[model samples]
Target: MRPTDIESLIGVGRPAISSDGAFAVFASSRPDLAADRTVGQLWRVDLAAGTPRRLTRGVHDRSPRLSPDDAVVAFLREDARGRAQIFVVDAGGGEPVQVTDQPGGVTDLAFSPEGGRLAFSARVPEPGRYGTVEGRDAAAEPPRRITGIRWHANGLGYLDRPAQLFVVDVPATDAEPFYPPAPALDEPRARVVAGPATQLTHGDADWSGVAWTADGAELLSVPDEIESRRRDLRDRVVAIAVDGGAQREVLGTTENLSIASVDVAPDGTVFALANDVGEGGVDFVAPGVALFAVEADGPRALTDAETIDLGEVGSHLTFDGDQVLVQDRARGRVRLLRVTRTGAVSEVLGGDLEVNGHAAAAGRVVASVASPESFGELVMVHGREMRALTSFGATARERGVVVPVEREVTGRDGYPVHGWVAVPEGEGPFPVVLQIHGGPYAAYGVHLFDETQVLVDAGYAVLYANPRGSAGYGRAHGRSIRGRMGTLDFADVMDFFDAVVADDPRLDGDRAGVMGGSYGGYLTAWIIAHDHRFAGAIVERGFLDPAAFPGSSDIGSFFGQEYVGTDPARIAAQSPMAVVDRVRTPTLVLHSERDLRCPLDQATRYYAALKSGGVEAEMLIFPGEDHELTRAGRPQHRVQRFDAVLEWWSRHLPVG
Candidate 1:
């Protein structure tokens, strides 16, 4: 596929299955060039016949949830004012009615077991402001107040408002509604209301992942500490009554485990994903599934074999009988697995395909799968057999996309390293680009990556590997480079690249370029500074100085202390800014203006240093964007980013 074809790709997410096993609903997005934006809509698929149809067409819609009785499908949609609110439609298809019109907008939502009430999380605005700045004159607006360490986030900017849980009653069919439904228009519409939402939690903590028990007595949620003392931020599972009672901690307090997501079974069995904390108050261990009896005893590790790290920390957990199903990232691919209450783990479906999102109900599992050749599609898994439910990426596949070849390389320390190489279509010896993934803790999967494909299509070979600090390679492998970020991980990357160049005859090692973002960006900057073998480098949203990061970044207070420790000398030695005078290669620095994780000051400091040393450097700052620029940025901006990278590489490394 061509670079411009990026706009045509359809993005699918968060599939939810009805309790009766009749149909499934999911959120999807496609380019709307006329509006200069991507439009998100809800779609449904019949499980038995494998037929799919669109349900709701809104400006932006997502997070679909099917009610218990399978009569209503509730979802979140952005209104004309760009505020997200809950909307519901009939299962058979009809006009959707807006349920809640909160000012701050809802972040996450879930339907109660009885379908009588909907529980959602919204940012609690200050008194009398109602979570909005609308209708107030600018001169009369109150001054902004800041009282917390995490006053801002990456994507959602300033955190003046704190997220809290709320409950709203679903309008009864025969009862008089607060807001009457609008006349059925040709296009989809929402019934705007004044007020019906009742606040439940009043604390300063951020509550997320709201799940209700089978009896609908209490709502289970994960509360994250966001105050100044964030180093003590261990997530706890809290139970809040549906009738506005006191909230109590359920688990993850005494053991000091960092709990993330939680799920409750019909029999009061609770399953959660938690990471063990070391004596230093850092979660250096890999996360795994933990089981809690709720009444008998506290949480216990279900999988302690050292091979299982619950793939996505925030992945949804579903209980089927006595087994809990979840998606896990193993090696480079994501697979669906079933973990029994007895701690026996088995893979239900395993392959090179990446499972983005999944939902299970009534003994059926549906997931959105993608690979190197295909962008994304919906598939239903039945034991070993699988059925395709949607053709989301047929056009891209038919047009012939590049597929990566997997290879294993030995690290300098004699450890196994997983890597992939995607060469251009016709090649003798091609200029190579070493791409690195973010999250020194995250791995590069065997999936359809837009950046990799674009690089290959631009007549360059792209190579990526899971270094020592990457996930899915077991706990020890992930934590090996925690305190020594640039020492061991850097060696593994350079060794892997050298091995790949030696094994492949079609790779031109002399004209190599390096690029990465986040943690990968840190490595790219480090590589060019230490070993000057590359002709060019692209550093995007990377951390440069561990000393400056502790005060500037959103997670600044604990990040340096947990990853690099408290030694001032060691922190300075590991920073790329310390060795800026050693960098001789031309570099392109890309950063988001509002990025809170690494912050824009990181790029500014690095760029100033590079220029002062007479190194060829350029910086591009994308406005109104955060750290997720490459993945979920605007369609126009994404295309522009790809074009800029291709142009920069072509000019610096001349492939002819």
Candidate 2:
């Protein structure tokens, strides 16, 4: 696919299945070339008939959720002022009604068990004279007092506001709609119809993944209690009563594991995806599905030591009767697996395609699936049968797409590395670009990646692999590079590249380039510093100095302690900046101005050092963007990023 094809690509998000498994609703985005932006809308699909239909047409809508009774679907949409407010529409089809009016936008939301209330998490401004100001005023007026270590996030920007849970009562009838009919066709039609929302949780800690109990009397959530200054604080599961009583911890105090997501079963069994702390460190712990009983001794891991790794990016867990339905990553594909209370794991639906998000009900699963040729579409799973619900990427597939061929390379340490190689249509000894994935813990699976496809379209062979530190292989494979970031993991990357080059004579080793973001960015920087086989390198939001990173990044204070250790000397040694003087490859650095994860300073420091050493280097900073620039950035910006990569590679690794 061409780089411009990004605008036409339809992207799908999380899906919500009705309680009776009759229908499902999900959020999807398609390019609006007229507006020079992508517009998000909610879509519904019938499970029995397998027909997809658009439900709501909004500028930006997401987080579609079905109420318990499946009468209405609640979703978040941006108002004219850009604040994300919760809106509800009939499950069958109708105009959406606004439910909340929070100054700050609502994020993760959930419906009450009885479908009478909606609980949502939103960022509320700090108590001050200028606190209530929102939209353009809040952006223009910014002279804030920084008080805490975790004050800024990569995409969301300054954490000056606190995220809290709010609940609003839904109306029993729609005789008088929350909003009146629009006078003009283009005017917004959402009006606040629900009662004034009551604040549920308070304080500086951020609460998310709100889930209601089976009885509809209480809510369970994972709250990051920032009691200490250390960035390595672990979040705990807490129960908040519907009556607004004091919240109580469902799990006992133990900082060993960092809880990611939480869900409560009908029998009061709490299930979570968590990373168990080991001697290696906390940040590198491979997340696994676990079950927690309020009366049992403690949480018991359900998928521990298994080959399947929980999809931590956007995966969720829910109870299907006594079985816990989980979406996880195996090899390069995200699949749905059923885990019983006795630790028995079995595949329900998934193979070849990547399941982005899913919701289960009445022994049926509705998920958004994507592949190497398709972007993302909705699918339904019942028993052993799976059927397509949407065909959004039919045009792209018809235009001829480059499908990656999977290859397994033996690492220097005797471990097998999984990767994909995608070649252009017509080529001979073509320039190759080695693409690395971020999260250091995440894997590049059998999914359609825009970045990889763009490179292939530009007449470049793209090679992406899951090295030693990547998940989906096993727990040991993921934790192999915990303390030794640049040692074994780096070796695995080089080994995989060497094996691919030796086997494929069409790939030009002399005209090779490397690029990656986040953890992948870190590896690209590290690879160039240690070895100069690559002619060009692109580092996007990478960490160079571990010592400085722990202080400047959002997860800085604790990430270093977990990955590199407490020793200052060892941390410095593992950083790419330590060996900058030995680097000779031309490099391009890209970073977002508002990126708090790796921060802008990390890029600036590396660029300055490269220039000082008389090395060819260029730095580009995206304004008002964050670490998720490539994945969820503005449409135009994403095109520009791909263009920049192609331009850089052409200039440095030109193929004549």
Candidate 3:
């Protein structure tokens, strides 16, 4: 796939199964090259027919939810002003009825057990801030009085506004139409007359993961302490009475645990996903979130934390009849796992696939799944078999231009390092480019990632690995480099590259280029400065200096401190800028103008030091973009970045 093929990629979201298990609904998305934006539409499938039917005509409709009786489909669509608003459409077909008009938009839409009420969340801006004052723009508004440490985030600018829970009546649709008997186009569509919505949550905290209890008397949610988490990273599950809006703590994290998602069973059994943060306040290393059953006493672990990495924080967790469905990341593949009442876990779907976004009902389970050969596609599991429901992602793998072959090697302390090597067609000792993933916690999975595809099409072999610090392999592997950033983690990366090249005769180790973003960028710069083996390096949004980060980055307060602590000696030892004078490879510093995660100062400082040290270096900054540029940036910008990367490789590590 070439840079142009990036526009041809297709993706599918999680499926929402009907209570009766007769049908399912999901959102299908594709890049609109002409508009340079992503567009999606809702599609429905009759479980028996197994054929998908278009359900909505909106340009970007998503987050589909099937009403209890399956008469209407409640979904979200961005309004003219780009704020997501709730809309309801007949399940069979028809126009959508607009619901609430929120100031900051809405998200996390949920329908009550009886489908009488709709619950959603939106950030409430301060009295005169965030466009709350009509006719007043953000720039013209009063300056904010800073008080919170977690005030901003990448992709999302200043986050002074707190997200609160809201509930509104989901207007009644035509009595009940189980699946068939479509509604006529001329017939009047269901209308949700705007009524005063009840704000069920208040305070400085953000309320998310909204779910209604079986009796519909109360709502269950996780209240995040946006301000106090920096002082102590912890959260708890709370139950709010729907009538009076009074909240009471259902359960709080014990010792080193942090709450992710929670749900109340019909019998009042509370289930939650809790992350092990070691001690609540600091340790930012990648820790596995496990399933827990909360009772009057305390929370009980339903899944092992040592070996099972239950996906990431806030992963899907729902209670099916006699079992619980959850997403787990094990062996680098994100799969849907089923846990029984006895705490026994087994893979129900996505065994060899990267899966997420799941819904289960009447013994039928549906999830959005992907493989190395495909992007996200809807997959379903019924009775004893799992099958793919869509084939839109087949074009993503193209015929033979790109092939990613799995590679493995033994790294530091004899740890088994895993990765993949994608070689272009008709390659002879192709110039190899080693790509590292961010998160130090995020792993390289089986998805058909567009970046690796674009690189191989440009006639360069790409190697990406899940080194020691990556998640999926377990908590031990993820926490191995907590206070030793430049030690074993770096050794594992180098070992993986060296071993892969030695095993594959087609990979030219000498004409190599190392590149990555975020944590990956930090490691890339650290590698070149320490080893000087690469001919070129591209460090994008790297956390180059740990000392200065504490003051400038959105996550600065605790990011570096969690990595190597606040000790000056330890920080300098882990920072690449401390050894910038030692770099000898030609480097391209890539960053965004508004990346609050690493900030623009990191790249400018690193590049300046490289130039002053008599080394070849260039800086490429994308204006009006954030830390997620390569992934969720403007289509034109993503394409332009690929072009620039190919151009740099042509001038430096050109293919033989």
| Number of the top lDDT candidate | 3
Cα-based lDDT for every prediction: 0.79, 0.80, 0.82
Ten residues in sequence with the least summed lDDT for candidate 2: 127-136
Candidate 2, superposed: residue stretches over 4 Å from native: 31-36, 128-131, 134-147, 178-191, 278-284, 287-296
Tens-digit per-residue lDDT, 541-603, candidate 2: 997778787668888867777777778788877888888888899999999888888889989
After TM-score superposition, the amount by which residue 564's alpha carbon in candidate 2 deviates from its true location, in angstroms, is 1.9
Poorest stretch of ten by lDDT in candidate 1: 285-294
What is the per-residue lDDT of model 3 for residues 1-656, given as tens digits with 9 covering 90 to 100? Answer: 87777766777887788888888999988777677777889999887658888899888899898888888899989887787889888898887777778878887788888888898888787788766677887788877667767778787687767778989988655433323334887865444344557998888887877878878888888877766435556667788888889988887655456777777765667788877666555555776788888867888888988788885533777668867888888766887889986899988876557886888888888888877777778877897888777877767755333648887888857888888889877647888999998988888888788888888877888998988889888888888888889788788889989998988888889989999999999999999988978889999989898888976898888888988788899888899999999999999999999999999999999999999999999999999999988877777888888888888888889775
Question: Backbone clashes per model, in order?
Answer: 0, 3, 0
Per-model TM-score versus the true fold? 0.94, 0.93, 0.94
Give the per-residue lDDT of model 1 (tens digit) for 1-656: 55667765787787888886778998887655466577878899999996788888778888888888888888899876778899888877777777888777899888887898899998776754533565665456577676656676777666666788888877543334445456666744444652488788876677877888778888888887666555664667888998865787887566676766777886777777766664445564344434333444777677662566665634667677778777777788888778887778888777878777888877788887777666677888776788889888777776557889998888887888888999987755999999998887788988777788878878899899998888888778887887788998898888889999988889999999999999888999999999999999999999877778976888787777777778988776788988889999999999988888999999999999999999999999998788988777777777777888888998998788
lDDT, model 3: 0.82
Backbone steric clashes in candidate 2, count: 3
Error at 416, model 3, angstroms:
1.8
lDDT of 2 at 567: 88
